[model samples]
Every structure is written in C-alpha cells, then in structure tokens.
Target: MKMISIGQLAKRTGASVRALRHYEQSGLLDAIRQDNGYRLFDESAVQFVERIRVLLRNGFTLDEIRPVASMLAPQPPDLRTVCADVIALYHDKLDELDQRIAALMEIRASAGARLAFLEEQRRRGGP
Candidate 1:
C-alpha cells in the first residue's frame, strides 16, 4: 500500500490540486500528513475523486454531495433509507430540469415568433 503525494493523487484522479484540497476541506476526502508537512493520499482516493466528479457532472452540488459521499464511506449503515432519500432528491432535480426545459422552450417559441413577425414587416416594407 504505497501512499502517494497530493500531486500524484491529482494526476491520477484528473482533478486539480486545488480541487483536491477543496474536497478535503469539504470533508469529502481525507489526507494523511507526513512529518515533512506533505499531504499523502491513499490509492483509494482515485476512485473517491472519480465518484465526486461524476456526482458534480450529474448536477449534484458540493453541499449536496456531502451526504452521498458519507453514504459511500466504509462500513456504511443500512442504505435502504438513504436510497429512498436519494431517489427523492433525484426526482426533485428531474422536476426542476423539466421546468427549466419548458421555460427555455417557451422563450425559444416567443423569439421565433418575433423574428417571423419582423421578417414579415420587412417583406411588406412596413419598417
């Protein structure tokens, strides 16, 4: 079990050093400090960071990821309840996305109508 420095972890995880530090600060990761004051991470950090990245890409905010991260920790308790809660969160996110898509669609239709109306006026020489 070779412990690696933060830089190596960042390279392996494709996450910036600053982001790694931020994750540590956010309690999403843990690092061991050497006597020389260098931060070392376990190899398992690679997968943990990947999970974090996936969650972020999937629209989960850092704050929202905290609990999910906890659920993935070693020796997690019964996950049935957690799964239910996560399902609810996902549903809420889906609802919000639906609303946003509808609003954008409405805006697109209005803009298209305005453009068509302007084109008709131009064709009619009505300014």
Candidate 2:
C-alpha cells in the first residue's frame, strides 16, 4: 500500500495543512502518525479529500457535509437507503435555495420600484 505524509497529501490535493487537520479533527479523515509524531495519510485519502471538496462546493455546510463525507470512507452503506437519503437531502436543500431566491427577487423588485419613484420625483423637480 502506498502511503503519503500529510505534507505531500496537502501539496498533491491543493488543500492546506490546517484544513486537513480540521477534517481529521472533525472525524472526516483519519491520519496515522509516524514514530516521530508526523502524520501520514493513505493514498486513498487524496480521493476522499477531493470528494469532500465537491460536497462543500455544492453548498453543503460542514454539518451537512459530515454525513456525506463519512460515506466516502471505506464503510459501506445499503445502496438503496443511501440513495433515498441523498435524494431527500437534495430536496430539502432545493427548497431552502428556492426560498432564498424568492427573497432576493423580492428585494430586487423593491429596489427597482424605489428607483423608479426617485426618477419620477427628479423629473418633477421635487427635492
């Protein structure tokens, strides 16, 4: 089995050492320490880190990402159950995003209306 030191893992994965440490602290990634107390990561951890990056980029909070992140580990989940859970999570996130978008659109409309009113007042020579 090929093993990489934490620094090499960080360099290859474009992740900061601190970030990796955080992941380790969060139980998202595991590192074995050498006799010298330096951390070593398995090669497979690189792929796991990449998966974490994907989950986080897709707007998953750390808490939300943690469960999904655990899935990337070697432990196996029942495929159908896992798929259903993921679908549910996606639906929930979609609803939240929809609500946020609606609120933003409402704010934009209000801003536009205010702008129009100001423009009209300016044209009428109102201070």
TM for every model, in the order presented, reads: 0.80, 0.82
Q: For candidate 1, what is the TM-score?
A: 0.80
Off by over 4 Å in 1: 74-82
Minimum summed lDDT over a 10-residue window in model 2 is located at: 74-83
- Give the C-alpha lDDT of model 1: 0.83
Which runs of model 2 end up more than 4 angstroms from their true locations? 74-82
Best by lDDT: 1
Candidate 2, clashing residue pairs?
Answer: none
The clash count of every prediction, one per candidate, is 0, 0
